[model samples]
Structure formats: structure tokens, C-alpha cells
Target: MGTQAPSDYSSSAPSKMDEQPEKQAKIDEKLQRQKEIDDWLPITSSRNAKWWYSAFHNVTAMVGAGVLSLPFAMSNLGWGPGIVILILSWVITLFTLWQMVEMHEIVPGKRFDRYHELGQHAFGEKLGLWIVVPQQLICEVGVDIVYMVTGGKSLQKVHKIVRKDEKDSIKLSYFIMIFASAHFVLAHLPNFNSISGVSLAAAVMSLSYSTIAWTASVHKGVQADVDYGYLAHSTSGTVFNFFSALGDVAFAYAGHNVVLEIQATIPSTPGNPSKKPMWRGVVMAYIVVALCYFPVALIGYYTFGNKVEDNILISLEKPEWLIIMANMFVVVHVIGSYQLYAMPVFDMIETVLVKKLNFRPTTTLRFISRNLYVAFTMFVGITFPFFGGLLGFFGGFAFSPTTYFLPCIMWLAIKKPRKFSLSWIVNWICITLGLMLMILSPIGGLRSIIIQAKNYKFYN
Candidate 1:
């Protein structure tokens, strides 16, 4: 038997040697197929928006109700510090965005399609989940709550102007409910890409209202008899006020949570499968953001100084129609924006439940869970209608991590730059700044909230 086996082995040995390269070729082909699958972008024809549309989506994500608070933020920081911080935040955020895009190319097969994906890649999966998901929920849901509070207040203002007799009779909660009802329908839309048109409209609305708010501020400033210089009643030196103001600025510039999602919508071409269009879109969007944000902060603060209300539109004295239109624009814009921010939350929840837990996403479970989440946010918004307080709290506690800390951490972790090198040092500085803001902003926000809550009526 041993002699027979040796005879067969001797006969096939040369053929086996000849087959080695072919086997290796098959393995390589399989690997190439796998790589193709891994690097594949999920974009479909309808979802593949152009760069400009992506830019609009980015603008829509960023320039929501936060713009209305810039003047008050400027008041808290004074013109000097506020302008400096605004520009700095813009630059830093843009740089971090570039880092994020660069990091997308690091992992060979996987894409950081969501914000949490980047965190998961940088750190352990569990820590990334804990780090990114809660902040995203808080930032997005908290922002929606702020929208309800602010939008309701704006609607109340509009009603007061349009129907003065019934102004005191209607409750703010009613307006919130109306807005939420409209959003209930809108939020059910399938995905953010489905609403690119709405996002574009929201971007335009943001510009319209920002311009209105700025023009109104200038109009009021010119009409005033007394000269209120930029630094009047300055609180820049006040420890709590300055940090709180920085939180507002952070909130104004905070769109990182949704950037990856928006970037995924930009169609990748065969020649450029990487995120080059995404970079262009980000640049264009940031330019628009800077243009929209800088003037609003500068002019609103210059006009009203420390007298600037938390909602700048509240500070404006305009014709009834103009005020109503401006405020209504905000209401409409936030109505759309609420869904914009909430989409990430919805996607995250659905993904975890369906993918991890093996729950059915297309079933009633999805509908019920999403609607209930919306209801929960609505309940919270109606319960605490303190707009500025919510803005500051979320900005500090949520936006800081999502907007600043996580980006730096992701870059450092993925790139693994030389220890204590310039990149390392810069990341640490960012991390430190983020930590400081995280600690201080909530305190200031809570103090303001408690102070305001003392006199706040739920439906007033």
C-alpha cells in the first residue's frame, strides 16, 4: 500500500506544482472582489446628490436656530472675544472636518459612514458607542427641543403681532404642538437624502431670516438716540458668562454630527471614488456658514450690545408683517430642521435595534419606536421651554464632544502620529479646550435655566 501511494504522489507532484500559481490567482481575485464590496458606496441614483446639494445640506444642518443666539453670545463674550472665538471655531471645525475626510481613507475596506462609526474605529466599539451615540442623541434631540421652544416662542410673537387680542389667550404649548404635529408627518420621511430639496429650502430660509435679523438689528441700532458701543455692559471677563457664550458659539458652529451622513450623499465617481467632492462641499458650505454667522453675530451685538435678547429676533422692533414673516420663516425652518437633526437619531436607533438585536425595522416596531421617541422629545420640550438654557446645556455637554473632542481623538487614534509631536500637541489642546467648555458650559446654562425657570409659565 505504501508503494502504491508513492506511485500516485510521484505521478501528480509536477501537476500540483503547476497549479500553485492558479490557486494564488484565485485567492487574489476573491480578495479583489471582497475589497470592491467593502469599498462600495451605498449611493443610488436618487440619493447621489451633487456637491452643491451636499453643501446645502451641510448649511441646513449647521445654520438653524443657533444663528438667532449669536448676538446674545456676542453680548456674553463682548465683541472682541466673540468674533475671535467665532473665527477660531470655524477654522478649527473646518480643519477637523478635513481630518475626518482623511481618516475615511485609512481603514481599507470599511467606511466611516456615520459619526459614531468614526468613534468606533478610533476606539473600542463599546466605548465608541457610549461616546458618540449619547452625545448625538442629546445634541440632535436637544436641538429639536430647542427648536420647539424657540419656534413656539416665535409663533407666539407672530400671533401677538397678527392677532393682538388673542395673543395672550393662546398658549405657547399650542404652537409647539402644531409644529410638532407638522414634524410628525415630515420626520416619517425615509432619509435625509430624500429631503435634499427641503434642506436646500431650509438653507435659503436660514439666510433669509439671518439677513432679516441682522438688518433689523442695524435698523434698531441706527434708530436709537443713545450710542451703545460694542462693549457696553461687557461680560467678557465674567468667568461663567464667557464660557456660556462660547457654548453658544459652539452650538452655532456645531454640525459635525451629521457631516458624515451628508458626505455619503455626494456621488463618488470612478475617477474619484474618494471624498473629494465632499471636501469641496464642506468648503463651500463653511464659506456660506461663515458669511451667515459672522455678520449676524457682529451686527446683532454691535446693534444691541448687552441688551441683545437670547433670541435676536425678539430684540427687533419691526413692522408686524415683517416680524411675522421673519418669525414664521424661523418656525418653518426649524420645523424642517427638527427632522434634519432627528434623522441621525432615528437611523442609529433603528440600526441598533434591527441589526444588533435582530428586530424588524420595517414593521410596526419601527414606527412605534420612532413616534414614541418623537413624543418623548416633545414632552421634554414642552416641559422645559427654556430656549437659551437648553442651547447652552446641549452645546456644552453634547456639542463639545461631537464637534471638537471626538474629531481630535479620532484623528490621533487613527493616524497615530508621533507621540507629543505637533499633531499630538494640537489634538491635546483641542481636547483640553473641549473639556474646559464641557465643564463650564453646563454650569452657566443650568444657572441661567434655574433663574429663568423661576418665572417661566409652561404655556405662557
Candidate 2:
């Protein structure tokens, strides 16, 4: 045929360059919405994790223990001892975070998904598994125990008000079942934005209660005379003691996973090998946590001053106000726990049922099954009355290794020998010391478990 004029097929040809910005914008908006849905718990990207998310993660992680453990520390030691422990934890955590930030710089994005992966990249796959897995498990169990105990105490108080006649029916088993079920249900649902609000409020209320307790106790000169010889016996005392303390500290600082989960939701910038310049954000979040925790630990210890009970509420001078605020704290605490546990349980169920059994998790039947799992967890915790013991048992043997030691080891393993210099040696020393603490912590914890076991009659 003759050379005919080329037909104008530019409109017909598929070309991204020809798409209008508005049209592109609309498509991008749809994609972003779809992405949000696809990632139930988003990943923490370099950008989206700037402020609030990081703050929420840090505060939530620290609050669980500050409320419960501070009192225990104060009871065993004194205000002086409790504050010293808090300070020690703060220092160690700061050092760990600095290294963590450096590690993040190396791995860039989404490298810390399993936590163990960090270790695997650093030391070797085998060692990472051994350390990170147990450490994470322990940290998780500690959180579980803290929630169960606090939740039980709260429900008991509320039952007194709502169902005086059937008050006895609101047994620990009932509360545990209810709490566990609540977590399972919440976790299954595709909603978690509410968790941060509850955590922040709980933090505030916790601080308020600590302040009031300090005022009451300090005026009486109780705060002035408190001792702190417990440091000599604490995990920081030696390698073994330090490892145990590290386990406890891990409980005190386990919120990083929440941010890590959220990060999965964000769009990762490919080839951007830089650290999430939001080190400031992470620092600020941790600073808030340290501030909240330090005051509460100091004041609570000052107030109770070695006489504080495991439950800080019981030690408050004002029983009425104490019960009210404690109930609030406990309620918020349970809600927070529900939020935390829900995701893990749901993922676990989905993995087991859907992946292993090849069944979908979105169906109504699957949903019911998830709820049943939660119910079972709660029921066992409450009925057995071994919530705290179980937590300590698991934490001592697991959480310590996972959070503190694993991360350090992971860093050492992942980074090249060229990068391993004086700083690396210091990190290794800290990790070694933390491991030692993990070894000896079980002794004190097991003893407490034994003591508590003998007091079943008193607990009832």
C-alpha cells in the first residue's frame, strides 16, 4: 500500500506518561486505600513512623511493667533501690536503642520483621533462632501475665459494684476467660487504631496515681527513709544478675514490635538505604516512656517504700480513691493487652487454620473459633490462679533472651567484621552481661512462684 499518514494512536496506546495527573491521583488514592486494607497492621516505614506511632509503641511497651513491677521492686528493695533499678534500666535501654538505630541504618527497611531475623543477620541463623525466639516468647508471656493479673483485679472490683449478689460467680476463672475471649475477639477484628488512645490515657492516669501516692507517703516521711540495697542483689550486680534484669527490662521496653507491625502497612521507598531519619522520633518516644516510668517508679517506691504490694492499689493510703483509679488503670491495662494480644493470636490462628488446613480465616465460623481461643486463654489464666507465676516462668526462660541479648547478638552477627570495632566490643560486653543476668533471674522468680503457690488459701 502507499505510505499513508500514521494514524494518531497516542490516546489508544497504553502509556503512563500520557495519564493526567488528576486521573493518576485518583488511581493512587484507590491504591493507597487498598494497601491500608491489605496490610492489617502496617509496617513501620522510614516516613510514616515519625512521631505519634513511635510514641505509642514506646509508651505502650513500658507502661505494662511500670505499673505492676515498680511496686514489686519497691517492696523488695526500697524507693532508693527501685529508682536505682529504673535508672539502670533507662541507661541500658538508651545504649541498646543507639545500637538498634545503627543496625536499622544497615538493614534499612522491613529487616526486623521476626526480631530473630535481626539476630540471624548479625550472628548467624542458628544463634539468632535460639536467642531471639525465647526472648520474644518470654517478653510476650510477661505481658500476658501482667494483663491477666491486672485485669482480674479490675473485674473483681467492678463485679462488686455491678453484681453484688452474684459477686462470687465472678471468679478468677470467669474474669480470665472473659479477658482472654475479649482479646481474641478484638484481635480478630480488623481494627487497632483505638489501642494508642487507651495506652496514652492509661499512662497519664498511672502517672497521676503515682503522684498522689507520693504526696501521701512523702508527707509521712516514708519516702525519706527508703533504702536501696537491692541493687547489690539485682541483675546489674553481675553477668547473671544483669541478664535477669535485662529480661525484666525487656518487659519494660517491648513496644518496638507495634511500630514494626505498623511499618508493614506503609509503602517502602526502594533503594533508599538510609536509616529512617526519625531517630529523633524514636528517641522522643522512649524519652516520654522513661519520664513517665521514672516518676511513677520513684514516687510509688517513695510512697509504698518497701511495703508496696505487687498490686500498687492495695498499698495506696486512700483505699477508695486507690480502688477507683486502680480500677481505671486495670481497665485500660486490659484493653491495651487485648489490643496487643489480638493480632498475634489472629495471625497464629490464620496461619494454623488457613495456611496449614487450607481454610479461609474471613468466614464467620473461623471468627467464632478465634473467639473461642481467646475465651480458653482467659479461662485457664483465671481459674488456675497461676497467672503471675506462669508469666515469670515464661519470662525468665524466654523474654530475657529474646529482647535484650538477641538484639545485641543479632547486631554482632549481621554487621561485617570491618564494622566490628571498639563499639562492637562494648555491645558484646553488654549482651554478655545481659545473658548472665538471664541465668540467675529464675532463682528469685522461682522462689516468688513457690511462695505464691503456698498462699492459694490466702489468694482465695
Give me the candidate number with maximum TM-score: 1
**C-alpha lDDT of residue 421 in model 2:** 84
Question: What tens-digit string does per-residue lDDT give for candidate 2 at 201-270?
Answer: 6555544555544454455455556554453455533333333333444455555444344333223465
For residues 1-460, what per-residue lDDT tens digits would candidate 1 score against the true structure?
Answer: 9779988987777677778998999999979754543232222113366778768878888898999999888877766777788887887788777787766656765566788878888888999888888888888888888887877888888877777686356887887787778776776666767777778788888888998888777766643542334433435436566667777878886778788777766655456755787788888889888888988988887787777789988888576667778898898788778777887787777666755676744647656877887787777888899888778878898898888778998888788889989999988888888888888888777777887899888655
Off by over 4 Å in 2: 1-50, 78-84, 101-105, 108-111, 123-131, 157-170, 191-250, 256-259, 265-267, 270-278, 317-319, 361-369, 384-395, 417-420, 457-460
* lDDT of model 1 at position 356: 69
RMSD of 2: 8.3
The per-model lDDT (C-alpha) reads 0.77, 0.53
Report the number of clashing residue pairs per model: 0, 38
Q: What does candidate 1 score on TM? A: 0.86
Taking all chains together, each candidate's TM-score versus the true structure is 0.86, 0.73
